[model samples]
Each structure stands twice: as C-alpha cells, then as structure tokens.
Target chain A: MTTTTKNNEPIITVRGLRNTFGEQVIHENLDLDVRRGEILGVVGGSGTGKSVLMRSIIGLQTPDDGEIEVLGESMIGRSEDEAKNIRRRWGILFQNGALFSTLTVAENVEVPIREYFPYIRPPVIDEIASYKIAMSGLPANAGPKYPSELSGGMRKRAGLARALALDPELLFLDEPTAGLDPIGAAAFDELIASLQKRLDLTVFLITHDLDTLITICDRVAVLADRKVIAVDTIPNLLALDHPWIQEYFNGPRGRTAALSHKEGAAA
Target chain B: MAANGAGKARSSGVLPTEFISRTTSRDMADVNGTSDDHQGESVYRVAGALTITRAATTQREIDALPDPLTIDLSEIDRMDTVGAWLVYRAVRDRGAKVVGASRDEVSLLHQVSEFDVPARVRPEESSSFTRVLTELGEWVADAGSTLLGLLGFFGATLIGFANLIRRPKRFRVNAVVQRFDVVGVRALGIIGLMSFLIGIVIAQQGSVQLEQFGAEVYTINLIGRITVRELGTLMTAIMVAGRSGSAFAAQLGTMKITEEIDAMRTIGVSPIEALVIPRMIAAVIMMPLLAFWAMLMALLGGGIFVWLSLEIPPLTYVQRLQEVTPITDLWIGLIKAPVFGFIIALAGCFQGMLVQGNSEEVGLRTTTAVVQSIFLVIVLDAVFAVFFSSIGWR
Candidate 1:
C-alpha cells in the first residue's frame, strides 16, 4: 500500500474509501494512488463499485469515510464552488458519453473552458475545441452538429474532446469503449494512450473490456468488495493469485498473455 | 381494501387472513404465494360471503346461512383506514349481511360500512348534489385563482416584454426566432388554406340567403366585415392555439421531464430565457402576420363568391371594400392577433412548465393549455369589443 513517489509526490491519493447504501455495504475499504502522467485502469464486474470509486474520487459522490486528496487539496464535504474549482483540474467522460443534446459538438467541448477558464480568449478556446475534435478522429465539420446527429463512436469522441477541453491534469474515463464497434474501440484506446502522453495526464479508466485494459493502461486496479484487491502493472496483475483477477485476465476467449506482451512491447 | 381481499379470496376460493406491506399501496391481495406477504392482505369468510380482516388470525367464528352471506367483523386485528374502507366498500354494495360481532368491530363496521347504512342509500343523489356544490365552489375558487394568476402574469409579461424591447439580451433571440418560424411560417399554409375555404363557404351561404331578396351585393359587406373583424382572426387564432400552442406545451414539457431544463440551469442558462421568452416573442410577432395573410385570403375567396353570386367583378368588390371598411378596422383586428398569440404561447408555456409524471401529463397539459387559451382568446375578444364600443370605435 506504499504510494511514495520517486521524485514528485502523487497528485491523487485515496485510502480506505467506503460507501454503503442503507444496510447493503458496497465497499468496506478501498485504497488507490494515482501519480502524474500515468494511465490507470480500474476493472471490475458489474455492481462492483468501479463507477462509485471514480465518482468518489472526482468529488461527485461522497463516500461514508475516506481521505481523498486531489492536487494536494482535501475534497470531503467541500462547498459546490470549492468542488467546482477542484473539478476544473479534472475531466470525466461518462459511461453514456453524456453530451448535451442541445449544444453543438464544438459548444459541448467549449463548456468546461467557458466555465473554468473564463479569462481565456474565445478564439483560442474555439481553436482548441476544433483541434481536440480533429484529434479524436472526428471531422472538422462535425463541430457544428449536435450530439444526436453524431454516430456512437463520434459522440464518444466528442465527449472525450469536451473532457480534454480544459487541458485537465487528471482524466476519468467511465466505459469509454462501451457500445462502440471493435475498430472504433481500438482507435479510442489509441487516442487515450496518445492523449495521456500528449497532455502528461493521470488517467483513471473504468472498464470491463480486457482489450482496453491491456492496450492503454500502464497500471491496473481491480475493484472487488468495494476494495482494491490488486493494483499493479498488467504483468504483475496477471501474476496475482486472486481467482477473479486470474479468471478475468486469462479467462475463456482470451487471445493469450503473450499477445498482449507482444503488443505492449511493440508499443 | 375489502373488495380486493374478497375478490382475491373468492376468485381463489381460499380463506386467507394475513396482512402484509407492499411496495405499492394498491388493492392487491393474494391467497397464493405470489400474493403472499408481498401483495399485502387477504380475505376470510365469517359465515359464507367473504370479509376482509387485517388480523393475522381469526378471533371468533360464527355460523350463518349462505343465503344472506353474513360476514363477521369481530376478529379483525389491525386496521389502516384504506384497508377498512376497501372492506366496507366490497361488502356494502353486495347486499350481504354484515353482523358486527364485537363492540369495536360493530363501531368499526358502522363507521366504514355503507350497506343498509340509510345515510348512503341516496349516495348518488348526495354525490351529485355534492358534486354540483363542489364544482361550484371549485369553479369559484378556480376563477379567483385564475384571475389573480392572469393579472400577475399579464403585468409580469408586459414588464418583461418592455424590458426585452429596451434590452434585447434580456431574452434569447434564437429561441424567439425558432418559435416565430415554427408558429408563424409553419402555420401560414394551413391557415391561408382554411381561411380561403371559410371565405368561400361564408360567401356561398350569404349569396344563397340574399339571392331571394335580390340583395346579393350586400353579401360583400357581410363577408368582408365578418372575415376582417372576427371570423378570420378568431378561426386562425383557435387553429394556431390547437396546433402550435399544444406543440409548444408538449415540446417544452418533454424537455422539462428529460432534465434539459435542469441542464440549462446547470450551464447557467435560464429555462425561461432559453425557452419561454423566445416562444412568447415569436408568437407575438408572428400572430399579426398570420392574421394579415388570413384576412387577404378570405377577401380573395369572398371575391370569388362576389363574382359568382352577384355578377359583381372582383375589382368592384375590392373598390367597395375600400369604401365600406376603414383601414383602422383592419389595423384593430391585426393588432389583436398578436395579443391572442401572446396569450396562447404564455398559456402553453405555463402549462408545459406545470407538467409532471409521464407522457399522459404532456397530452393532458397540451389539451388544457389549448382549451384555456381559446377560452381566454374569446373572453379577451369580448373585452376588446366592449372597450372599442365604449370608445365609439365600433
């Protein structure tokens, strides 16, 4: 559970995070450490509190008891404006790609910037929105189209574009490849890796897709019983003695560990 | 509650007497496991006919003939008011003999029962009388409330519109323009067509009526005055209210239900500014234009009537119209159209904002908004007529 940094301190640290709904306790104690400039993947079964953990980290859902430090600031029971200030440093891509239907794709991308960086010139923001949209592999003309007009892949890309709009240091991706075709999902995974490198961002991604986990993640966190049973590099996670973790990584229909190793080595 | 219990017991032919709490407080009772503690309560028979009891077990059993279908209420343990009411309602209407076996049970049965309850024999008559009185009271209260709301809304709208005119950013231009195009431009074709046909019908009818009297030329004046002053404007407003007003309500209501309004607020955009102001401005601006178009189409249609009925040329009817109807009259009618438009849009928006629950609510609010708008339009028209008459403009 030691999370000491080599030189720079960890930007985000969570310890003994717990959340319960009535009598049914979701998580008893969960711990995580996210360093700067690393993509961390959180993989879990349905109802295993992956999203809840992400939400708690982002200060969207308050845990029953936990210490969450984002950018050296405590986030428990903070006022809305204070939390919003904290949120300005972080970006979240919701599972459903929660884009506002009324706003055009470009406007959607411009929202966080408009909210957080009001001092930034409109033209510069617009320029960045367009660039992010293009970087996500969406057409330039797609900026003027509403969320509803875009394809599923395009919508997710647009959502990612919006998430990256403020140049956030930390990014949370909730099921980023959900409802996407395999080609699009792979492209999105590549985009996530590239973005992480480009922005020097600490990414916390929640996903059920093993391909996504093996593809872009530098480290993986397995959430079970509302706790992080394992948090390590992909190779180390695969070597762990947990039944669910082993079954998850080396389960039926898996292409084999060597294939992932080859891809990681190639990258 | 009783009815449900009896129905459940009678249907399954099982005497079930356990009460259970359900998620939804419905008239649900089960003799089977499906209706177990999950569905709430079941019914038990005292003698023959089934009676509902909230008790876990029966206290006493009585023997009575199946002919009268006697139900004993003595053994009932716990009671909620709804459960008791349900039981009473089930047994009361069936002419079944309900014998109160204990003092508390008799009092409970008497308190809730309507069968052989002499006071309830004229229930229909009493309900109808009560309905009439209730409706009267409700109508009076509603009228008072509506009048107050109308006054408040009218003052607020006038102030808002005035403020908007002074400062355009006070309202959403995109919303207004969108609503205007939707209300006015979209409705133009249908309103024009309907007005034309109405003119034709009025002219034909007037011509037939005047033909015997050799006064067919007078049909020009009749059709002109009616179409210009009342029929054209009224019909067009009613049509638009039914079409566009209801549409506004449904669209806004659906948006409200879907949390788009909340999203707008979260983004620091006012729902009123983003939605209502635009619609109100659009409707007010477009109504007069639609009314003017309607007036022209009606006149043209009447021209056709004049040509067919009296052999009066279209040009002559036009000339006569200039002589008979003052431009002020046309202006007065045109001016009222936008007012009608404002009212319709406001009503629609108000009702739209009031909508809750589901799709049924959207439909209900849409209907209510249209009906209310049309009624207000007619009342306003009457008020306008009276005002005009008092001013010697009539």
Candidate 2:
C-alpha cells in the first residue's frame, strides 16, 4: 500500500450539489472537497445533509444539481459497471456496520477481496482476510465467528476490515461510532487514526458525535442552512462568528474539540 | 362551624357566607354540604376559573391541604391552575382526603400526562408465567400464519417453474448453475445425511413387510419407487426451503433494512440485476442437482439394507432395479428438481425482498420462505403426477 500524501490534489470534488425530498431540501448548492490524505469530518445536526453529502460524493445518491468528480472521472450518469468500478476506488463504513449476516467474519472481509481479486489463491485470501481483521483491531479467532456471535464493536471492526480490503485511496464513514459507548468510541477513533496513517487513506467521516470530530478529524465541515457554513481545522472552525457555531465550539462540544486536538498534537 | 366563617375571612378577600354561596356554582360546591355524600370520606372540590399544572405541583398543594377537605369542582366553571391542580392533587396525593376528581381536572393538571401517573386503584402486576405464555402464544401464532402464507407463495412459484420449459429464458442454465452452488453445493453435506437416514428407514420398513410376504427381492422395487417418485423431490424441496429460502429472506431483509437497495438505485444499479438475478440463477441450477444427489443416496442406503437383510447380491439388486425403473424415471425426477428449486429460490428471494421490519423481519420472512417453497413444490409435484399419468407417461 502506498503511503505518499497528495495533500494539494483533491481526490473528490463536489460543486453546487443539491438534493431534495418532497418540500424538504437536504442540500442547497453545497460545495466541498476531500483532499488527498486528509481526514475531513462532516458534522451537523440531524437533517442538515451530512450523510446526504457523503452519499452524493460517493455516487451512492444522485444530486439534483451538481457535478461530482472522483479520481477525475464524472460520477453522474455512469453505467452500472462504471459506477461499480468507481466504487472500487473508495471504501465505506456503514453506520451499523452492514456486514453480511450469513457469512463468518473472515468471509465477510473476503467478499470484496474475492469479488475484485478472484485470481488470488484461497490460502492467500484467507491470510489477507485474517490480516485485515487484525488490522481493524479484532482478534484472529473472530474471523471464524458469524456476525450474530460478535459484539457490536466487533462487527464494526469486521466491517472496517472489509472496507479496507481493497486498500482504497478514499474512505467514507457514516456514524461509525453511533451506538458505541465512550470507551468503544475512543478505541475505534484510535483504530481509524492508525489506519489512516498506515494506509495514507483520505477519510470523509460523517458523525454527530462532537468528541469524534474534535479527536480525529483534520478538517471539520459544519453543514447548516443547506450548505457548509465553515470548513477548516477544528480550532479554526471553533473561531467562526456564527452563533450556533460559537455555541457548538465554545460549549461542552468545544471542550471535546480542544481535548481531541491536544491528543492528536501530543501523538 | 364558627371556623367556616373565619376560613372565608383568611382568603385573599373575606366574603360573606351568602356572597360565597351566590358566587360558587351549584355543582362547584357540595350543594347539600353533606360530608357523608359517598361511601368514602373527604370529598374535595375547587370552585373558581381553572387552569392546569404539573403532577408535582399538584402533589405539593395536596400535601398542604387539610384532611377531609371536600373539593367542589362544579363551581369551577372557568377553572385555572389553582382549581385544576388543587382538585387533582387532593385526589392523587391524599387518597381518603381527596374524592370526586374528574378526568377533566386530571387532564388539566398533570404536566407530563403522556406517562402513566396515578397508579391503578388496585395495583397488581401480572404474573411472569402468564405474561410469558401470552407473548409465546402471540409469537407462535404469528410465525404459523406467516409460514402458511409463504407456503402458498411457494406453490405459485412451482407452477411458474413448470412453465419455464416452454420459455427457456425463464430458467436459464447459467441462472440454475449459480443457484446450484448456493442451494446444492452449499447444502450437500446436510441433504446427503438427511436423505441417507430417511432411505435407511424406508428400506427397513419395506424389508419387514416384504419378508412377511416371503418376497424380499421386491423390496428393491419398493425402495426405488418410493425414493425416485416422492422422497427425492419432497425431501430436496424441504431442505432447500429450510436452507436457501431463509437465506434469501435474511439477505434481502438486511439489505432492505440498511437502505442498500436505495443506495443501489442512486448508483444506477438495478436491484433486480444486483440482487434478484444472481439468487434466481443460483436456485434454478442447484435444485435438480441436489435432487439427483439425494436420489443416489436414498438408493445406496436402501441397497445396503437389502444386501444385508435379504442376502441379495449387489448384481442381483442392480438387475432387480432395472426391472422396475428406467432412465425416463430419472428424467422425471430430474424434471421435478429444477421446478422445486425455482419455487424455493423465488419464494425465498421474493419474501426476502418484501421484508420491511428491522432484524426481526429477517427471521420472519426466512421461515415464511421455507414453508412456502416446500408447500409449492409438493403441490406442483401432484399436478405433474396427474398430468403425466393422464397422458400415459407414468
């Protein structure tokens, strides 16, 4: 896996993105870019179009009005095979870790690996599957267990392993720590940070958790009024004059932000 | 008493007894002023314009109120917080001291009225056993009804499969091959063991009966006829229903729950192409092969039992088998296999795609798929049997 950082280049760029359901406009002229090797945390209150933005960028949701370019290829109006091919360049960690329930953890990790790289020997696939599982911070023995037997956090790790199976250049996570307790959420955040560093992955994370944003994200994009109100480092984002932003960054949330930055700085 | 007059004097403004009587409505105040109006004592009433407040505030007022205070609400034509809470609190906080509290008063008083407040007069929780059994009964009934509906769906699927020979695209070899891996390849060990045991039981029973008739050689025919005509098709269908049918429901159900189908739509991936086509193809291919495997096991099991009990040589057994059945018999069985396969796969995947609930719906649809697939296979077999017999093929 290549670890060279491409900080100046934008791997994913969205211009004037918009999506509406019924009378509720989820996104209105939203514009953002996920730069190479940067962890961008997309944050907003519920219904502020965080997940919608991520989905649109990943070509999982069609934008009503926008141009999306990933890996310099236009994502709109692509063929199914083309879309799948584009998808191969990126990885997604679903909110609930949408692991295949019928498969064991090892087989779950092996899905993308086998689907995309079927020529690899079975023993090598097993080895790769086991390595990815361990990389996600799960025990080696966890690979043989079905999804039902594993705990919530374990399922998430297994899901992350699957996402990382293709060694994606860009990774998208939706509410990755949604239901986990503080301890679990913190550990997951660490795993994400380590993976990002080791694999040189550009992560676009959507989360409501202030702690996660403060602790892990290199840049935070605050979505409000159907577009990004601010996009900068957590400290700079906190310095915005918007009342809601001020309250968000200066209150309990801001403390989490400061703590996370400190930890990152210390690390 | 004399205190009644003083009580009127202590209020915000002291009013004459006659003035108070005129101000308070007939319903608001105890008209008769009889303390012993109800079987219970302490009938409390509030008379004035009323508004509502929270239960906690009501409790505070009730605690401050004197015992046996008769709250006359009829006089409260335009009651506000004072009248509503004072009356409600008296009833809730002071059981004997509060009485005649109406629903309107309570509704107006409780701040968080959405919750269950004011415990039942006779508070008694249900026993665990009764509660458990009641839940169990509901679950079982729900499961049973869902299974029945699934079976009906499977029956319809079988009819479609039978018609597939007329339209080859409906049951393509590639599709069948894919399903063969899922339903047949994946399920070999389980199906083989089950059929093998069932075959042994059938042979043992046939041997006992044939021995009584002093003609054990015909036991071979009995085994062949039973295995090929019914058990092979029926058992394979059942196994597929239990294994593949439920799998489809769960796979589809999880995707449905996760909004993956929606995701696919956004990415321009046809859900039918991405999900249904692959599973359908797999089922179409696997069913016949599984049936073939099951038939061979059943025969092997029966052959072993006959060779041991009847002392019939293996060659003699093979010769006896040739006398009763033929390649056409195998073809008939093979024909039913794919039809059964399509039914189980279609029923399972269809039911799976139909899943709506959370994880709970997956288990529900799975059971439904299995039952529906099996039922449809059997019904289709019966129709085929009659149709083939009438045409003189059987």
Candidate 3:
C-alpha cells in the first residue's frame, strides 16, 4: 500500500521475444517494459510459460529470438564474462528455494558476497550475511541450519536472504508465495514490498497468489496465448474485457482477496 | 587565528582521504569533502560509492576513525545495504551521528539498523581432541545399533516370507522375475569375463612354479581345486555385491526420500514384500547358478591356457581336473553361494531402509551397502573355509 515514486524509464525492456522448447512454443513476439522501482506481478494459468519467461529474461534459457535490455545492457547473445557486471545487479529466487544442500543458510548468503567481493574480510561478510538473514525474517538461529533442516517456508526465506545479499538493484522472484500458508504468504508479500521500497529495487515477480496481486503489485502482466495479453493495475485490468483476465480477477477466490485487501486498507 | 587553524586541520583531514570515486573505475584517489567546524567536534567525510565491492576498504576506514564521530555521506554517489550496514554499525556502536545522507540512503541505513540481531555464522565446533573422541564414540554406538537394526530387518524379512507363504496369492511373480533379470541375467557377461581372466592368470603362474620341479601337470590340480572350492563363488559374490547391492540401496534410498515407500504403506502394500523380498529371493536362487557357471568358465579358461602355453592337450587337462577336483569341492562352493547372496541383499536393503533426509543419504547408504556386504561376505567365507576344512571336505 506504500507507493514509492517510481521513475518512468524502464529498468528492463523486452521486445520481439520468442522462446520454444523442441516442438512446443512457449512464447512469441512478447513485449514487456518494467519501469524502475516497481513490483510487477506476472500471472497466468498453469503451463502458460510464466517461469519460462522469467528464465528467458535471466538468461537461464536462451530465446530463439529476442532483444532484452536490463539496466541499459543488452542481455542477448552476451558471454558470461561480458554479463558478469549486469548479473551482479540482479538476484533470483527460484521456487522451492533451490538453496545449496550442503551449505548452511548463513553460508549460502555469504556465497554471493564472497564471490563478488573477495577482498572483504570474513567478519564483515558474516555480519552482512546475518543482517540479510534477519532482514528476510529468518530467526538468528536459522543461520547455522542447512536447507534440509528447515521447513519449506524457512527455506524460502533463506533463499530470499541470499538473493538480497548483494543489495541487488533488480530482483526476480518465481512464485514467492506459492507454497506458503495464507498468513505466511502475506508476511512474505509485506517483506518484498518493504525491501523493494527501502532498496529502490525493480522486482519482476511471478506468482499465483491473488492476495499478493491485489495487495502489493504496482502492476500485473497477464500471460495468455503465448504472449502477455495485458499489463496494467488490477483495477484497470479488471475493467478490460479479456476473458481470462476477467475470470482471474473476478473469480471467487479473487473476490475474497480483493475484499480482504480493501478491509485491511480501510482499517 | 583559531578559525584559520581549524580550517587547516579540516583540509588536511579531508584532502588525504583515499577512495574509489567512479563506479566502473577501480582507481583510488582523493575526493572532495569538508570536516568539522570551529568547534572541537570530530567529523569524518565518506566519499565515492559506498557499496559491497569496496566494503573491505570502507570497513577499515570506518574502524580507524576516532570515537564521538559524525559521518558525512554527502559525497557518496551510490550506497547499498553493505555500505548502510557499515555506517549503521558505526553509529550504533560508537554513538556516531550521520549527516548529509540522501533520503534513499537514510532509509537504507535505517532499514539495516532495524535488522540488528546477533547471529552465529557457523555452528560452534568443539576442540579437535574432544571432537575426535566424540566422533569415535558415536561411530562405535552407530555400528552397534546398525548391527541390531540389520538383525531386526532380517526378522522382518522372515515374517514377510511367512506371510507370503500363508497367502500364496500375495506372492509377486513379476517382481521376482524382474529382479532375477537384473541381479542374475544381466551380470553374466562381466562375471564370466572376470572369472575367465582370473583362471588364466592362476594357471599361467602355477605352471611356471611347477615347471621348475618338472611337474607342470600339477597346475591343472591347482586351477581346478581353487576355482571350484574358493575363487568361483567368492569372486562372483564380490562382483554381485559391487553391482547389485549398491543398486538396491540406491533405488530404495531414493524411494524413501521421495516418500514412495510411505505411499505404498498408506495403500496397504508392504514395501518389505513388494521391494525387498523379490530382490532377496532372486539373489538367493541365482547365486549358486552363477557360481556354478563361473566355475565352468574358469576351468575352460585354464584348459585353454594350458593347451596353448604348456603344450598340454585340452583332453589331458580335463582328465587331470576331474581327478583332482572332488565333488565335495563343488558342493562347498555352491553351499557358500546362497549364504553370500542373502547377506549381500540384506546389507543393501537394510542400509537403504535406514536412509532418511536428502538425496545425499542415498549415495552414502549405497556406499555403505557395498562395503558392508563385501566385508561380511569375506568374513563369512573365512568361517566357511574353517568349517569345511574341519569337516574334512578338503
């Protein structure tokens, strides 16, 4: 609900993006522009390539054809060495956490810092890691525990801690609240919103949680028919006559989410 | 004079300050800044980008500054959480006041200060001597419990067998046959080649020693007795333990991790009967047959080597083998085979059932299965050797 003044200049620009896996086409001629300092929630039905689009932007999956400009750097066809500087500016949190199984939560957070700034002393890195871990809402004791030792929710927080370790300008969260309970999901959404505001981050979020969309997202982009069908605020999107978008926002669960959001805001 | 002296002191303090000014450039140089006024107050100016990449240098500078400090951040081009943390920690610990920070930088510093929980980076490790002693004690206790667990598993397997016998309709014919194809049929080629090569090496070595005594024909006796009574079943057991025992542990461990075994239990299907029993039965039934086949292959290899290298005919070699290798030697080898097979399968399945937690447990359990089964097989073979000798079977 706290709206930071976002700039008009796009932090990320995608045009004519096409992606395919063997015979299956996931996207074609997709266009998206994520403005600076805004949390853009991406939503679609299952198997509509929400994750695939995220992967394409992060350079994990190379698109057959596209132009991707992130922070004014062309992302397509760039080698790893060339992408290192740009890569450092963004952090990604995969679904299910995808934490390193062997390292503890604190150690996982330290990994990115150590890799980027090897000259930093161990004590400083440790202090920074603890700060990030606490900022992500994990308990202090959860630092020493491995990924396997924690619950699904704790693991996701640990993953977020690692993602925010370097104070990345851009953050990519794939289903940040997918497996969380209702209360836990709301807390996570609040954390994301607060962190984005404090750090001036441009968040590209993929989610299925209606409450998340209604509560925190500055804008929602709908993926359908192998491309983003519409991109606008939830109310504006609801006004449109797109069938999928209509059902998505006005559905039973969506109505309940909207009502609760309104009630919470009123209170 | 006082104002001029304060101006000189402030200029000297700010002029020599070394910092990286540009984001892309790594060059360190003096940047613009102004310190405290005419009063005796102490102020430190931080210039350039205060980010993670320059955290080491910034931390050192922050630590070296005098107490009752006022940090000036007006010259900072960029600032991140790491930089904010550095500034926040100084202010909190040293009671320093921060001035001239941008709105965004002030918020970032405030946010970093809010997360001021003391967290241990790693688990506390005990002293090396105590750790070693503790590890040794834990290992012994683990081994003791593992032995007891294996015995309990054996009892469970026996109960499973009894239940299947009581209800013959519950027997899984397809599962057992599939296990037979995996544990027995597929292992034929490698086991055969290994036994054949071992036979040739033994014959070649034995003939050389016998030739010195002008009794080269005795090599046939050595090859026949050793292959039939000891090497055939023992080597085959070792190979099967390496190949099939490790696989059983890995498969079952994966199933346990994925909760497939739990699902089976919920559906009223016994994993012991569905998974372990089929593998156990197949190993028990196939070991003696594989051992017998290995013994024949070894004899054929030795026969061929003797015929080619020693100029002895295949017929003569076969006749000598028949005379030296008694029926009791074959019985001894075949009798040991089923016992070895049972131990291998039990060790594998036992380790697999013990696996919990992540996929790493599967790899560890698989390794333990192969090692424990092979060690038990060798120990049991030694016992069989003593018992057979005492019974005058040799």
The most accurate candidate by TM-score is 3
Question: How high is the lDDT of residue A102 in model 2?
Answer: 72
Give the per-residue lDDT digits (tens) of candidate 2, residues B36-127: 55433344444443332122333344455566555544434343232333343344445433223333333333421121122211124579
What's the residue-level lDDT of A217 in candidate 3?
93
Q: Model 3: per-residue lDDT, tens digit, A1-267?
A: 122345488889999999988999999999999987889999999999999999888898889998999889999989889899988889999998989988999999999999988988898789999999999999999988889899989999999999988888899999999889998999999999988767778899999999999889999999999999889999999999999998988989999999999999999
Candidate 2 overall lDDT versus native:
0.71
lDDT of 2 by residue, A127-184 (tens): 5566667668887678777777788888888889888776676888998998899899
Clashing pairs in 3: none
RMSD of each: 25.2, 23.2, 6.8
Candidate 3: which stretches are off by over 4 Å?
Answer: A1-5, B1-43, B66-68, B207-216
How big is the RMSD of model 2?
23.2
Which ranges in model 1 have alpha carbons more than 4 Å from their true place? A1-267, B1-135, B155-167
User: Of the candidates numbered 2 and 3, which has the greater DockQ value?
Assistant: 3
What are the Cα lDDT values of the candidates?
Answer: 0.71, 0.71, 0.87
Chain A TM-score, each candidate: 0.92, 0.94, 0.97
Q: List ranges where model 2 is wrong by over 4 Å.
A: A1-3, A256-267, B1-394
Clashing pairs in 1: B1-B86, B2-B86, B2-B87, B176-B278
Pick the winner on lDDT between candidates 1 and 3.
3
lDDT of 3 at A261: 91
| Chain B TM, per prediction | 0.65, 0.62, 0.86
